[model samples]
Target: MKQNSLRATVRARLSGLHDAEARVAHVVLDQGAQLVHLSVSDVARLAGTSASTVVRSCRRLGFGGYQELKIAAAREAPPEPRDELDPLTATVRAAQEALGGLPATLSRTDLSSAAEALSGADRVLMAATGLSGAIAVDAAYRLRALGLPVDLPPDPLTAHLAAELLPQRSVCLAISHSGATRTTVETARRARAAGAKVVTITSYASSPLAEESTWVLLGGGQDLVFGMEAVASRLAHLTIVDTLSMILLGLGGGRSERAVSASAEVTADHSY
Candidate 1:
């Protein structure tokens, strides 16, 4: 018999759960298909929570018991055999699913705070390296469109120097998917040491970049579409930039409208 899917429903309720139940939920959510076969005790050991906690969490999800949870999980598991879809369809579906989870994972309050920080900063220096550097540049342009003072240099050394020179009320926002990018992390650290606020846009909340940040804006959803260079991460970062831009615009009043209009007029003649 078919059972209602609980994976999505359970994840949505994770924050409302008790610590022990939440831990068990994280294990189940992270393990996904693998959990379908793991015994309750096995999951307890992996989540570092007790088997009773797992059972309780399952019950909270409306399951009659752990066995019911496993049964439902198996029923809702991804289509058997990984290669069920053609290559193109699989790629598109993967990207879609990764992007689709953003709405649930991202925090509106955190994003709003980040936007305010950027909008109210004395100066803004955005930093990243390699692929993420491109994202930094894009964010700089988007912020600049609102007439906000934004700087993003392609050179890592120059970017580092800019961060080190940031004064009070200034901000250095670093973009990194892994939060472990060495140059970006160091740049953020130097900026914070220089008396500037440091903001990090990353996927991991506990990463080094996040640790160095005064505020963190999560990109929402995992960026496993293709690893570090995954296009999905870039999309996530861009979404964050766009969200901040809109918030800043709303807070800017008439001034931001004028800036955007002026930018559009200037570029209008250059476009086909």
Candidate 2:
């Protein structure tokens, strides 16, 4: 099997693993067949846990031990000749699976609370860094097109300062795929300290950013592979942004539609 196929197999069983075991599974799955080369201790270190967690994850996956798991993974059939196309195929499949599973992961109450925070806020500050920074900018454009007051500075410090100075009844939408981006997490903390409602969109619900959020929107799926930044996590974050925008627009009713239409009309002047 191709590396992605191996990851798919492990991911399918992740739901059944205990939390620590699940983290181990994710680390293994993300590493794919490469996990076969790493000893249990290495995997434990990479997964931010102990060897016992790796062993438990192996058992949870129905293996006798980490070595057995590695051997089994090594024995799987190699990818077909068309494996060159697998990356694209795998990424699309991952994004679809992730988006399909999102509703079950995030409840209507969670979405509703997020929409309420954005809709009621006098100003909306978007904080993000790296790839997530692009997502924040895109989301801010979409929200501002509907006449919502949005601030999305390209500079991290500027964004952080915006979060710090956010007034009461303001909202800060922090986008961080890892949920561990120090700048984004710190901005979330400062936003809350200034009494602004914080909405966090992240890949994991248990991340530090989620803990700081007044409302948390978990991405639909976990990223199984590295080096593919736009595959699962980016799609998941964009999906959450679009979903929240729709929900906020729905709550705003006809007035919001008119705002969006008017914004489009103004921008149409630059079109060919």
Candidate 3:
């Protein structure tokens, strides 16, 4: 099976397992390649579980033993080939991997909730910082083109103000790959306090932004050679945004068709 599919399976099964098994599973899913070099006892110790439990967990996942499970996981894992590629190719590949990782990470429930929020909102506000700020603007523009009332805050202060001004029954959507952006988290908290529903698209569901959100969208992440390169996390976040846009379009029904047509007509006058 593809790595993405395997990841989905692991996530789906995670919560169903007992705590010890869950911890073991998390270690395997989160650090699969690293685990290949560790013995069963070492992995068990890392997960705070007994070695026998680790073996049982491996069996539950269809592996005959812990070693087999590690081998399978390593085979499905993405190659960290940064050193083998030129700068441009590595950068492009990282983005591509991130995009590829999106579908499995996102949940249908989250997408549906986001669509409902957008459809019911008086207005929608999106905010991000740095590279994510550009993505927020693009998402806002797309939603606007689809006839949704959307805004993108220009700065952290403006974002906070916008969050505070969110009326009851409105929606505020925050985008952050790290899920630790202080401004975004604070804005989301304020929006929620103001009685507007808040949605967060982020790489970590356990992140602070997720803690403040009514709806949480998941994305994927990959280690990168440099912090500046657009790696898997950014691409995953963009894909989540794109998926949310599509969901909103579907929710708008006939209005979406008209809005898209208008956008096409407006774009016809512009050239590269």
Q: How high is the CA lDDT of each candidate model?
A: 0.74, 0.76, 0.76
Q: Which residue pairs overlap in candidate 1's backbone?
A: none
Can you write out model 2's per-residue Cα lDDT over 46-139, one digit (the tens) per residue? 8889998889888876578898778766754443332455777767766765665565455579889989878878999998998888899889
- lDDT of candidate 3 over 1-272, digit per residue (tens): 44544454455345446788889888887675677688999989899989999999877655688987776666566556568888787777666655655665577887898888887788898868877787788788888888888878878899899888988988888888767789999988889999998888876556778889998887655555667434666677777778878887889888888999999988986856
How many clashes does each candidate structure show, in the order listed? 0, 1, 0
- Model 2 C-alpha lDDT versus the unseen true structure: 0.76
Clashes of 1: 0
Report the error of model 2 at residue 63, Å.
Answer: 21
- Best-matching candidate per TM-score: 3
TM-score for model 1?
0.75
Q: For model 1, where is the 10-residue window of minimal lDDT? A: 220-229
TM-score of each: 0.75, 0.71, 0.77
Compute the lDDT of residue 149 as modeled in candidate 1: 88
